[model samples]
Target: MLDKRRNSNSKERIDLINRFIGLFGKQVIQSVAADREFVGKNRLAFLNRNEIRYYIRIRNNFKVFLPQKNKEIKASHLFNCFKTNQFVYYNKIVRINEQLCYLSGCKLNSKNIKQDFLIIVSFNKPENAQEEYQKRWQIEMYFKAMKSSVFDIEKTYLQDIQRIEKLILLVMIAFILCYKIGIYLHQINPITIKKHGRKAEVFLNMG
Candidate 1:
């Protein structure tokens, strides 16, 4: 039950939701919201199972699960308990600080604990997460190379949508050609080039 919030009023956004629904089916609930904070601040959904609860928080003191008992409990109560405990029991240890944990029971000739433990810890530096996120620049680099180096997309004179699309397709074809040629050259015999002498030979002949 991972929840994702989107501005659903726009036709583009609605179409995106429809695409997901077509693949995953109607059981995927659709909720319209003005902004991400609305979904985070308001607990508009419920935990269907007692075994586990999943939620996201926006405002500082947001409340979550209610006590099944007649006595009412606020979200702060659960947060306080979790903060104090510093751990949640999932029949065994499940979550530690920021890391997820796993424990194995004894049996089947195995040791008391297995090697499946996972620990997640966050850095205290303000820019650590941002730096990690910035590592995605490789994707942007690929796009830039495709549009400029491989496709010469900026050189295209067409303004019509269909012609622009055809130019994009041609650019993709050029990239594929370059990639295949690179792979083929990499698989050629290096020994044959070495015997041909340094002046005439390609330095990176691969085989």
Candidate 2:
């Protein structure tokens, strides 16, 4: 991972994407998904030019251009008509700069009138875009495990940045091992806490 004072620059992020393509080849770089942090005109254009499908989340305040209706719309305005767990799609090509994308909005977990919404801008209408967007949380959980749940890497007092990075790498390896063990134990017994679709596969910590 590229780190610049704990934050990655746009060039670093792009280089990482290019590195992934170089290592795995174009065919393997089918699609890349990221949250709003990765959203930018250059990044989106780069992915589009390279024909790499991307499902990047957009902030509600981002402006979107509707090609079909010949009008501009704020991402937040797209959600006004949606209900909880309801997905609204704009399959017609939309413009962000000169780059074209498909826009999708979802009102998630709406039962409590909570303002949970998602905006996805993608290349073409990627199948199951909402499901794909949800996968971002899996990466988040990995970081959570590395920092607090299992490895507790955040409590370390290492002074050298390089050493801290290496230590975190080691903790990452340990987290992977623990995850494997957790999955194995889950398969052996399959005890689930929640009955809903989202939480059905969540297994109790094997540790």
Candidate 3:
């Protein structure tokens, strides 16, 4: 757990993760995916230097230097003519923070118009970025289940960093167990798909 006073940016989080995994010298990470909060020039450069594959989403207005164009352009500008739900994968890679990366962009047909653009920068397989980024939503759903529906963790109102870490660790343990049980339960009897296009709830609730 990070101290409350410490202001952690993408670099710090990535460094922390790298350090943790460094203990296992031969560990191999398939790829890393993160929201815009973790997207920055230094962070991207660091990942590139380490040859770490990544799919980091960026805001529509993020500027990248296009070598072909010999200028910086907002991500959305490259796909300005794209229709809703239309995805564009640039043939040539671009430079952001002087790090070479590919870009895959989409104009999502979501209710929130302002945030419709889903732009992802990656070290490879830009065409697969949009779909890969969708999996992050599943992680968000799990956190929501812990913080509200299932564990109600927010009510604890933790302040001390050590106490918060302990609480989060316990919650994480429960979450892992419940998620595993949920998977097993689903294998026995599939979950019912509700009208909202998702299973009624995590199968753990059925257990």
Candidate 4:
């Protein structure tokens, strides 16, 4: 998933995903959650074709066809149609690039007019989609910890990509060890995180 060449376009993204699948096999992956930048019609189709459950964040301006309402509308417009703090969902087939696929949207939290500021498109029910998408944040946090919070990976003087990747691997191993130690400490002390206002990972790493 590391590419310095900036081959991050939709085609390259799909190719990388397929390559991972080829290496690990489909059973290794259960579901996927990605940011809006990694989502498009073709990419969704690729995930769908492989029967991988995915929840992808969509831009507010992303177009979706609502057959129930018999109209095309932007994702933001759909949000405005709902009341604040209300749980709502729409299940329909959305057309993208002449291809039609199932689209589901769920509102996680609500604003004054738009109930769902963070909209997710998925094949699963909207009720659970946001919860699943939240899992992706763990990966984001891990990367953040590696880059600056703990490892400061960006400060590396090495220019070689291979060496950089190896350094990242070492960092990952160290992170895993720290997390395991953290888990063990948590199990022994059983401290409630709400009281200390410090994350278990941070507290454990400090130990």
Candidate 5:
């Protein structure tokens, strides 16, 4: 990963994306998904220009242009008529930072409506955008395992990029091994899902 004292610049992020796309070739990759951190004008434009599908979450207050209605508005305002548990999707297109994107969102099932909402911008399959976004959980879990649950890599606090990458590589290898074992065990005994479609524990973990 590209790292700076603060957030890595857009160029570095784009370069890293280029490196991975080059390595895998665009055809093999289905789509890329990320949170708001990766949702920027240049990056979204690059992905769209390259014909790579992306599902990225955006802030509720983020501004977007409605090509059909011909007006710019806050992302949440698009769903002004939507109620809790109701989803609103602009399947045609929504312009964010001048990049055309499909928008989908829903208000959370809680009383704090203003504080809880999920808005996603995507290139394809607006109906499945939220489901596609769920894939990011695996990456999040991996990061948590590397930092605290398993390897505790953050405790070392390696500042140098090379050293940090090396440590991550080593922990990554171990994580993969554990992941394989977790899969094997899961196949034999399957993870139980609760009423909410979630397992009490990570079905796949550093076991």
Candidate 6:
């Protein structure tokens, strides 16, 4: 019983560490965890630690809150919560790089003052974020294919609950079939196909 309890505690500690590692990269994780100041603050403020200074930007939705805080505080403050909270620093005016440009114009809603200002946050490590964001797209694509193509989810002629359950089962089976076929095709070797083609050619020549 004691051994089992120890193992459970160990696993819990490891899970906590891993969660920190995921939020802040391994190098920063130890520093962030050891820093009591960061841990004590609100989790939303701690999210800023996940971002690097050079890669920080804020959205236009944040502009209203900005004026209420500090004028000199830059968009970087959104991702630098420690600085923002400590110094009461809010907005920092930054020059947009003309060479590394973003869209200059945005359509603003006349009724909403918030919609008028749009802030673009560019990251120095865009490639890192790009791959992670692409994984989300792949997941969305799979869900779309499952719902529309394999499942025929929209063609639900069944109004009854029991009939709806049957439709769901049919859709699941279709999705599994498609997934298995895709896996099998991906495993096939081009070299084996080429070798078979050569053997067939030789057989034809002999014939």
Candidate 3 vs candidate 4: which has greater TM-score? 3
Candidate 4 lDDT tens digits, 42-123 = 7877877777877788877788777667787787666566664454556566654444554445445644674446767775
Clashes of each: 2, 0, 0, 0, 0, 6
**Index of the highest-lDDT prediction:** 5
Runs off by more than 4 Å, candidate 2: 1-3, 110-116, 195-207
The local distance difference test score of each candidate is: 0.36, 0.77, 0.81, 0.71, 0.82, 0.37
Candidate 3 is scored at a TM of 0.87
Query: Model 5, 31-101: lDDT tens per residue?
Result: 78888877888888898899888889998899999888899888887776688768768767878998988
Model with the higher TM-score, candidate 2 or 4: 2
**Residue 15 lDDT, candidate 5, scale 0-100:** 89
TM-score each candidate: 0.30, 0.85, 0.87, 0.81, 0.88, 0.31
lDDT of 2 by residue, 62-141 (tens): 88888778898787677768776678786577887568888887776645654667888889764467877778788989
**lDDT of each residue in 1-207, candidate 1, tens digit only:** 113345433344445545666898646542221212323211221111111112222232332222234343332333333332233322322221222222111112225563221111111221232233234454454476665544446777877777777877876676667656756876784234455464343222221
* Model 4, runs deviating above 4 Å: 1-7, 83-87, 96-116, 195-207
Write model 6 residue lDDT over 53-163, tens digit each, in one string.
Answer: 222223433322233343434333343433211222222333232112111112323465433322332223332332332344444545666555444476667677777
Regions of model 5 farther than 4 Å from truth: 1-3, 110-113, 157-160, 192-198, 203-207
TM-score of 1: 0.30
Please tell me which model should have the higher lDDT, number 2 or number 6. Answer: 2
Worst 10 residues of 4 by lDDT: 198-207
**After superposition, which runs of candidate 1 have C-alpha atoms over 4 Å from their true positions?**
1-141, 189-207
Once fitted onto the true fold, the runs of candidate 6 whose alpha carbons sit more than 4 angstroms away are: 1-128, 160-166, 189-207
